[model samples]
Target: MSSRDTMLARIRTALANGPAPQPPQPDWAAPVHLPLPDAELAVTFAASFRRIGGEFFYCETLAQLGAELRAWLAERLPDDQQFYVWEPTLQALLAEAGVPFQATEAEFKAQAAIGLTSCEALVARTGSIVVAPATASGRRLSIYPDQHVVLARPSQVVAEIGDALRAVQSRYGTELPSMMSLTTGPSRTADIEKTLVLGAHGPRRLTLFLLEDDA
Candidate 1:
């Protein structure tokens, strides 16, 4: 037999003598977990997020959140700049506070400078925000705007990505959302000359308003 044929025969014999390989397990079957304390999680997430140019805010109550929102808008946005909010509860809260925001998709697309929405979970391990299509206002609201603001409660924060996934599964059960997004910091890229550029494909800024319970 030729040398190549001899080598092939030896490989075949080795394979025949060895045990069959098992199929890989599904993600849900063998999920990984890493938990953290709530206080440590918030601190770690804030530090990691800020390192990538993300802004963070903490509010003790809805009233404080509204006040902060108004102050931020006044300082950062022009009077004519349009803002969009998707969540109904948030919409009501802002409307009650007399914050001008667009509710219709048409108006939002026409003059949207900032888009505010709620997230499914906040991952403390990677400093990421998990947004599912069904829970959020719309897919485009998070991607098309110049800036994205997330309204999250302290209870929504999880230790890691796996824990976040578990939370989604537990919340939605079999009727999961069509899509889920894990966003970390602002959209940026360092593809050209190794110089970092923000807003390469999506929102240039990411701000998180984390609501805490009254003490």
Candidate 2:
């Protein structure tokens, strides 16, 4: 027999005689939990967000949120420009206010200047907003538009990324979303000549409206 064939036959005999190799067991540990007080979390998150050039606003109720949104739209955007929104209640409110918006993915990508969507969780530790594609806020809505407006309730804020992930796991159980995005602020890059530039890849502006629970 050829040397190559002899080597192959010896390997096959060894394999037949030896026991099968077992896969290694993972030494998995539970995630660490580091909880922060709510008041502290709000303050830290606001400071961090602003440091990264993100705008933050607080609203006590849905009515206040609507009013603030209307005022913001009137001041920042042209009346003729349409925004993208997926939340049904917010869409209704905008419609009532005569603000233009596109709900479909194609229309939003094609014509919308601003994208408004609800976030899955707000990470207070890093002042990041976590969004899942499986949720109302799809991948395109958060990244396509020039501006991004996020609506988040106070209860949705968590201490850190781990906490936010745990919240997702707890809510969804075994069936989790396919993808999750953690956006810290407006897209920026300092790679070009060490000078900071905004809107490097995604939205140039990020505005977060934090809804506070009624007392």
For model 2, the stretches where C-alpha displacement exceeds 4 angstroms are 1-35, 92-100
Would you estimate the TM-scores of all the predictions? 0.79, 0.75
State the lDDT at 66 in candidate 1: 81
Per-candidate Cα lDDT values, in order, are: 0.84, 0.82
For candidate 1, write residues 71-92 as lDDT tens digits. 8887776566678887798788
Best by lDDT: 1
lDDT (tens digit, per residue) of candidate 2 on 103-150: 766655457688898878988888899988876666878888889998
Candidate 1 residues lying further than 4 Å off, grouped into runs, are 1-35, 213-215
Which residue pairs collide, candidate 1? none
Per-prediction backbone clash count: 0, 0
CA RMSD per model (angstroms): 6.1, 9.9
